[model samples]
Target chain A: MNILLRHRIILPVVSLAVLLAATFYMQPRAMSYFGLNLLFNLAVPIALATIAQMMIIMVNDIDLSLGTFVSLAACVTATFLNDAPILGLAILLALILSYALLGAMIHAFELPAIVVTLGMSFVWGGLALFILPLPGGVSPGWLRALMTVKPPFAPMAVVAPIIIAAVTHLLIVRSGIGTVLRGVGGNARSVQRAGWPVIWLKALAYGLAGLFGVLAGMALVGLTTSADANIALRYTLLSIAGVILGGGEFTGGKVSPAGAVIGALTLTLAASFLSFMRLSPDWQIGAQGAILILVLTARLIFSRKGAGT
Target chain B: MTNSMMLFSAAGLALIAGLAEADTSGKRIALSNNYAGNSWRQAMLETFESTGKQAVADGVVAAADAYTTSENQATEQAAQIQNMILQGYDAIILNAASPTALNGAVKEACDAGVTVVSFDGIVTEPCAWRIAVDFAAMGREEVDYLATRLPDGGNLLEIRGLAGVFVDDEISKGIHEGVAEHSQFDIVGSVHGDWAQDVAQKAVAGILPSLPDIVGVVTQGGDGYGTAQAFRAADRPTPLIVLGNRQDELKWWAEQRDANGYETLSLSIAPGVASLAFWVAQQVLDGEDVAKELTVPFLKITQDTLDEALATTPEGSVANVTYSLEDAQQVIASAR
Candidate 1:
């Protein structure tokens, strides 16, 4: 909120500007159709997940179960609510409450997020499997229609993710907990010395990560019009990619929300570029793996260069 | 490491022969693919390039070239088209990105005297003939099986692949049309599995507790395992008449479930897409007058015929046998 804080957000803002500009330039035609469903629902959940990772990284922790949480939340939602609109609401609330409790447990005990979240993800995956033996549930056609029908300028998928990210970022920066998160990132030892509830802040961080998982799940469930446990698994790596791509670090340091957004868009663009090249599906996989590596290397190089200066 | 792994490992061995063909023969072929994220893509590529190599070895074509990429980007695939132009490939097979982005590249390929073939996936653009499978028709084929039996009517649960992918939409579209005339069947649930076993399993599990009177489940790919697991877990007898890809276990499960009083409507089809690709490749290469679109053989192997096919075939081959280069050449000649 302060002028100084705004200045700090500048680098990520600029990075996002560059990414959006490139996005416009690369797909001049898609510039107007800017809000496709894949972008909104499918893409946004991952973006928010990335932001959630950013918050955790700012505090020098990592949440490995973010993807698991999303997948599990989605699986539960579709299975329980496939027939009714209330299923969606019920699943969403259940996911948030369960994750919040888990986050509290993790932070209250001062457990390592890498360990805590990873274990939690496995638990969720197991739970999903136990619940759904086969992938054969019909979505309440209403939610599918709502998610698919793009609102005027762009599809709900694209806009919804952006809105979620914006709201999440506001909470991260403007709220009291947001300050503690930053403060914890700066010097958790000092924050603890200053008598802040360091444990609760970390717990809330995981809760935020859970929120990202559910949102991404919702979008994915909407995007694919079905939910799968493995879908979220891929984003685990991508979420990390998005976070690091956004210039965020996990070991309790600075994280730029804007950089995370730009990182996601850039990755999207890279994938699109591969499509334009008309490579084989086999080649596409290799190329995406290659490009993901390239982007990560680029991010690392830039981060190192920035650190050196 | 993966490159060497690809070379040293058998995972890409069938495709590697395709790379060798580029050098042995003078002509080059480039494959512009839309998305490589799914198993359907992998199985397709394995069958495609292997067949491409077989053709080149038999002197059916001058040379062969290949490229692979992901579905996330369209421009990069378009760029690959240009790359094919620079490389001077004799032909290009497009699985396509968005069906429209490749139009410019396809025209360029044709202009350069390079034949273009679209397979499995239709480019939606006007190009050389499309060697595509009739997904809509196939949907009817599967649905018809269920319809003729369920004259008295029953509940049907349809499981689809990726919502946006061509496979899911076209197949489901066919199902919608096929069941239109049939009055007895009601679609209970449609879950998106993206063609993964774990997903299929999870989806079936969610609905089992609620739907006690569910009749038949229509699925794509080898999803029988997922379905069976869900049924086993729920302490429900496996439905005898489930529709699925020809996995080995489906045969045993069907017999066992039937004995246990569950009517399973299951089929393990292999010669489905692989045969289509083989036929398409032959038709395109030999300049055959085959229909722009053709439907390959889809086996409806039930308990009666599962053993014979399994004995001669590999554990999970789509077809009883894969065609050699000579067979492909014949298919091509027959089309002409």
Candidate 2:
């Protein structure tokens, strides 16, 4: 039991399973391929956003600007990426570089990530509004087709998350560079002592986060086929919730790519389950909050029990 | 011309067109609403449900279920619309999250032979029929009323809605145009209220400290009561504020009238426009020659009708008028 509890992924996996079971019980149709596809299609961008948040969290820093940054990326994808591909790609690359520079600045100046990102949130939101002031821009065709692809065995919704989890897990959990990056988050002093450049590691983490954020935004526009300045503003809170739900802590490097993916899926399913129950809209949002609290409480109880033994 | 004149002409055409015998008993309709966070939206959902129940009982349709997204996000609403399509709803009445972001899902629903009718936050897809309020006219009329009330106008403060939204842009444009035409009133200050009372109060308070004595406040709907509150808090003489048809706004206006004979105009698109969209979707499904674009008249309350509107509107809700099938047909005829 202690070993199982110590395994960070188990809690998120169990929580996801329980929620999926409840959803299936309530609406058996959700078990089919088509129904599952419909239920989970929007989860793709959410999972990507969660993973992006996880990358920032892995470095023990919070990003309040992630939601607006994603919105800006989507705006870029819908406008520049559609009409002028080269300019769009260059802008996206510049955005990622800016994120890396931001990380470097934070580390060098010993600034609070929260305050910096909070200020940047407004900048990103303004830029997004400037890019697509009114919510009207056609997504590029290839991107749209890529997002809606249908494989034979499982739907793209399920397949996409699996691929995301697997690749991120391999890159962050198995590689040598992964060890150095985690070391920077776990103990920057010790990593610097060992001759690993802590500043570069933090920059790398933030740059990776930017990459995922861009992907999340592009995926969102592909699904909606257009962009709005405020389209993904809710993602900041959702991504933070996803990270915490997946057994990641606030001031530590402990994070699980698989657990975060499951957490995103669980959050998405919770919404689908509530819609299936057909609760009043007034209660629906409250019920969703209740579900989140229940899952977290269960995790707390199990962790306490595990510690006692 | 005023909306009443158009309605009178359309009523005659509707009677001559004769759309009473259409057969739509087997079709199922669904309301896909994006947000229900405010009093206005709550009133909208309630109106839709009550009107749907009546329609169902009269055998006008098989079902009229309403679904609102938890998060007011385009992605969530698109998914909801797709689910409605899968559930075999013959028609969908939508209050979209964004005008353009939901085009893909709406197009898919259209391809599946589902009739889509969008109102309030209407979609931009050509396949969907739109029931839009002439929001620009609503804004322009507010200034026009203020011009009549304060012929030699002083400084005015403009309270706008959520930024980056098309509705906000349109209304603000109209207000600016009205100012351009009137030339007496100068908009000295402007702030975004996000069409919420508390937000409006806070925004107005933030900007009022620097402005000169204002004679009027121009506002989008859902912000009038808040603007009044801010003026009271600032201890400034209350301005002749244009109001949205919220119960609280009307009630405040009434109290002010009793105390000081404050006369101002109140107008808003009725929350029951959802029912109009519903009936239009039904007409489309019933094989009626409904035009792709239709406009609903905004409800207006003047000093004379203030008491009547207040008595009819529920507390903490928006003023509303449920549209019957005849009203929908009249609107459709007028559009044609």
Candidate 3:
């Protein structure tokens, strides 16, 4: 009970409640029809991107390429998915593998993730453009439907990611891998000297990030029903906002699934709130910018307290 | 006596050559079109450069200066106009970024005896002739076309271009006016799509699942491209009619419907920018007395016309759409 209270679960729960309360303010017509749909649209991609970002943060590294990772996943999947049901799974697998390899290359050089991912991001985005020079490319119908078509508020889009988040929580907290990853993120050289395969640990981190990036790519394909270069650019910054405010470090050493979930909800709510206020869409960009600044400020204050304490 | 005759011959020859040169020089012309920094604007520039070269070959004018920017910085455009006036160009053609903003510059050019004809985007101050595609008519056409298809009148969603823009506001006004006559066609509301496909798609994805009976959709920009993806995935005949841009993708959709022998009615108002480009150039050259506001009427192409045009198009390409400035002058003249 003490752990539960101290762990900041209340912050997330309360934020989710605030989001729900804001929902009451929407037009009844829009509330009934589009509110959950909008949430679902943001959920899958944001969650996957957040998780991918968290993996990098755990190790004190950052994959600024997450948005690009998503685009590459879509470019690969869309170019090859071929409307076959089996092709969908193949595309998903190929995307994760491709990013994993990209991660491995970066890992081999012991390079700062921001620098590596930045270059990789451009390469991946270029691949996306090359694959779909125009907007009318075909996305597999089954995945697109599962991702987009809503059945009330209980859309697969919203539910599937929540379930994945739950499964991830059980794996990380209940398993031995979670403890080692935490220790490694806090100090990699120490973990390495202590005989933990540090490269594999970071490799696992990159692979996990890539896996989630592909998931976001697939989810985005469903939501928009068309994949393009711009989708990646939109989420590039938001994923960082999710992780930083969730209080995750740059290298994946210590992070919480619950906090990440809350971070996603918080970002989504903030956007919905501004949009609901009928503020010009321009304000949406400004509001997001402000949120990032506030989150960074809080992180600084919290870090100072931790040091002083 | 022999030295005097030789000197006279040299002076006479010089005088005759000067007369011949003056007769052949035609007139000097300059263009200062406001730029919107869009592909459509780029297409206009390409046409302008090509047309100017062609006109020069035809001796339309001595030369045409092409000045472009992302926004028609009225100050910069005014400076260019001043330069043209100083250089003594016969006239200037313009596309103003803002009607109210360009007042001082436009007035300056007019005072300098520089003939000014505006096209694409126009100014209210009325320096000279305003050449444009009938934006209001395009809006009415979309609403009327959609209502005709869905007589029982279902929920309608309007996706407009840049908010508060002449195209956006006038089309919206025209749509409301058109729908006012019908009991069935009710417009839900309008949202700015910014003439971008991604924006329109995201809006549609959010709006579509909620409104189960969206009988009609109105759009400005490549929104129809995004809308088609959603409808195709749902595997339905977008039973809802579309008021969409005449882009390659939308043209393909129209062709698909025609191939299956279904009547696809899409009302696309091809930009009057092309005709306006030519007309403004000619007017500036010919020194024609033109009006301050010239509204060019758009051709209301239906399935019949589209099918006929498609058959004639180069394989896999939509046929080029051409609009005549005279046709616009006639329509706007009649409307007034």
Q: List the candidates' TM-scores in order.
A: 0.53, 0.79, 0.48
- Compose the digit string of candidate 1's lDDT tens values, residues A1-309: 354345445554555556556544654444544323222234555676677667667777777877767677666656676766586677677777677676677667867668977887888888776666434344446655666564776656456656655775677666677778878877888889989877777666766766666766665554344454544665676677777766566656566676676566656555555554554455666786786666557656655776577
DockQ of 1: 0.06
- Computed on C-alpha atoms, the DockQ of candidate 3 is 0.01
lDDT of 2 by residue, B260-320 (tens): 9999999989988999998889888878788888888888899999999999998887788
lDDT (C-alpha) at residue B263 in model 1: 45
Winning model by TM-score:
2
Cα RMSD for predicted model 1: 14.6
Candidate of highest lDDT: 2
Q: Write the per-residue lDDT of candidate 3 for residues A28-145, one digit (tens) a residue.
A: 3224333344444455677778888887777777777788778767655555674555776776776667666665666678777789888888887887777776433446677666
Instruction: Evaluate fnat for each of the predicted models and list the values in order.
Output: 0.11, 0.55, 0.00
After aligning candidate 2 to the native by TM-score, how far in Å is the CA of B109 from where it should be?
3.6
Task: Pick out the ten consecutive residues of candidate 1 chain A with the lowest summed lDDT.
Answer: A33-42
Ranking by TM-score: 2, 1, 3
User: Candidate 2, TM-score vs. the true structure?
Assistant: 0.79
**iRMS of every model, one decimal?**
10.8, 1.9, 20.4
